[model samples]
Target: MPQLTLYGYYKSSCTTRLRIALALKKIEYTTVFIDFFNKEHRGAAYAAINPNMSLPTLAADEGDGQGPVYITQSVAALEYLEEAFPDNGVHLLPNNAADRARVRSLVEVVVADLQPRQAAQTLEKLGNDFNANQDQKVKWAYDWCIKELQAYETLVTATGLAGKYSVGDTLTLADVCLVPGIQNAVERWGVDLDKDFPALAKIYENLKAVPEVQGAHWSQQPDAPKE
Candidate 1:
């Protein structure tokens, strides 16, 4: 394995997810910060790395004759890491196909369903298209996020997948997706996790104590905004 490089913004929830995955996998890597506020992701240099102009692009050295492999999108990067580093001892997906499907579904609840709607771009578009004020835009995003969080809580309980983690006893991609969304809800949108979503709050509390999760927290990132 050659050196790994991660390109992302510290404040992005998607980027935070990849950071947690890398930490859990114990992969040593370097970071190239893309300043989100300054539109650094749109620059020609980063555009060459990820044509989509997305955050959390990964470059992995394939060693030997193979050159560096570039992966974009947080979920895709995570799946790539799981497949490329299978023997590294950290598995993000379960071996059981059914369990894996369940985990993926939970992950989608956050990644596809929740995260996109709450993204800055989406919210900005919503505000412009609807002529909504800042408060209205925030309320709109918060409402949808709360709805999804409630759905996630129900899914965990109904499926009996609630254990020490999101889907089971061990950590999975679902937990990776869950933690950051919860963090954004609480810190960014002022959602009350403990009072409103106790199940997710419990899971969030437990996961926050984990060293990898704690280390990957947005506040701990080098490019996080200072007080």
Candidate 2:
């Protein structure tokens, strides 16, 4: 027993990101689920583990016989786990600071591009609508994705074919961020990669082939369907 645990929502893009990293690293963990639809994230117990009340909180082994080490935030959690137990697993930051900075820049754009849509959707779900403002926000999010994905297409083309993901032929934190952004766009926002952005189509297909990237959960499994 490695004494590691991960708290995540099966359908959350953020949760899906961390889950891929842990799986690729071959780290064993017990996954705890939080229902996003029912707002189970607001529960007291989960909030206690994550003050931000977010998904993908990883509890890694602290080398003690006691409980695992607690961590929150998918990005920070991934970085922390990598540094805490660095044994040649996938790395978010390259050894060179310049490379690391470049990687972080790409990662930031991916995250920044995704947040606007999420905010818009969350507000809509909560029934707050400024009419014109909401419409503009939605448009901005879609536009942002188009521009960012174009840039990503160029960047990946420049780098050539990576055997795994983002930066120098292995899965990195940037890759972790990339997968969820695509998932969000495709599932919630209904962006068609093949039709809207053919350049991104190849990358999306490649990512889908990766087992770690797939994880164990699917929102529309044969047994489960949206009501």
TM-score per candidate: 0.95, 0.78
Local distance difference test scores for all models: 0.89, 0.69
110-143, model 2: which lDDT tens digit per residue?
7665544564345565345554465665565566
Off by over 4 Å in 1: 64-66
lDDT, candidate 1, 17-76, per-residue tens: 999999999988999999989999989999997998988899988786677788888999
Ten contiguous residues with the weakest lDDT in model 2: 216-225
Local distance difference test, candidate 2: 0.69
Q: Name the best candidate (by TM-score).
A: 1
**In model 1, what are the clashing residue pairs, if there are any?**
none
RMSD of every candidate to native, in Å, equals 1.4, 3.7
Model 2 TM-score, 2 decimals:
0.78
